[model samples]
Target: MLVGNRVILVTGAARGIGQATAVFLAASGAQVIIHGRSEESMDETVRLIQSAEGLEPLRVAYDVRDEAGMKLAFKQIKKIFGRLDGLVNNAGIMTEGLMGMVKTTHIQEMLDVNVTSVILHMQLSSRLMLKNKQGSIVNVSSIIGTRGSEGSAAYAASKAAVIGATLSASKEWAGKGVRVNAVAPGFIETDLTAHYMENKKEKLLETIKMNRFGHVEEVASVISFLLSDMSSYITGQVIGVDGGMVI
Candidate 1:
């Protein structure tokens, strides 16, 4: 799918699926704005896009949980790009813990980073998009959010909340020319899932219908499609990039 020079912002673009998405979108011709916790963290992503001969991407760094930083980042987008055409809410943290042993602090942190920040970014993005009367939003949720997992209760909860927001926001914005959707990815081979892969690779492989973990580019391609006109008539849906793990 072609993004055709659309200005898009990808959060947590320093690594993993987020980084891959930024690179993929740039390759697809989208003018990407890559965000990370710090500018240094996004170096590799920047290099990858540049190496691919993609347009120079705007780099913005700030913790997703920082409200002021988030607002300022959007402001920068407006000042530089004049308008935002798409957003990928991919910045999030995964904290694994079982029921009773899970730390309250950890749960709260997940909520702030995964759920709250997503909502806020959508709000900010929609405002800019609405100004032009068009935009698309793609949220990166997790399969654990839809099907649940043994030790990822908090992370699941936060991701599930993202699904909820995606649905609600889609309904609220679709009539105004903006669309919102989510992708629930199953175990993906990324730094984020390295621990799980190391400890439960065999069992997880047996559970996956494809008998393998997903690749970052696989998820990135889906995110790009969602942000492009190829998915023009789609919204409020959570597409599973799970290799049939959810089924």
Candidate 2:
């Protein structure tokens, strides 16, 4: 119940960590907004939140890469909720292509979704948050952002850019009652990472000191902390929930 009466918006809420965070926040008493590119999936997430006795989250289906869509979505949010207390930039993708096979389009898409969307979301959200003189933003980064991963150069680069932006924005809004931070999750058991686990489950576990993949709930709790008053004194930092993998 860390976010009682708060308003939260999460990207990529159709499934995986985004869905988990949205549900968790709603259960904590926040009026959550579930956003994704798929209307059906967003609806499913809404159902789950309702099933858990959590508040029914508003579902918004829009591509994060669409600039106009982004503006309209945020504007619509303002029309509905009037103010946003927390924002989680969690929409992202990973393409598996070797360096030689990677194309320019793949790189651009990653940059657009992972890096550019985050920058613009923060820019607009900050303006609204600044008016209320209180807000929290959490960017969902990855361990690859810290340690470059093979076959994921573009993804790693985009996430690294997220970490950089989180640090910079945190500093910029320090005294404005806004806190910007990032959570770098490693080897999470989610739909996005299912393929890798299917093939290299044992190998991956060996790399993690905890000998297991991180859970979506674990990452969601960290998000809740950052969004709650518990983390009021913390900002501009990237917390790793990697099970000692990145250490």
For residues 48-137, write the lDDT of model 2, one tens digit per residue: 899878887877888999989889888989999999999999999988688889899999999999999999999989978999999999
Q: TM-scores of all models? A: 0.98, 0.97
CA shift of 111, model 2, Å: 0.3
RMSD in angstroms between candidate 2 and the native structure over all alpha carbons? 1.2
> Residue-wise lDDT of candidate 1 within 52-100, one digit each (tens)?
8889999999988889999999999999989999999999998887898
lDDT of each: 0.93, 0.91
- Root-mean-square deviation (CA) per prediction: 1.0, 1.2
Model 1 worst lDDT run, 10 consecutive residues: 193-202
Indicate which candidate wins on lDDT: 1
Poorest stretch of ten by lDDT in candidate 2 = 195-204
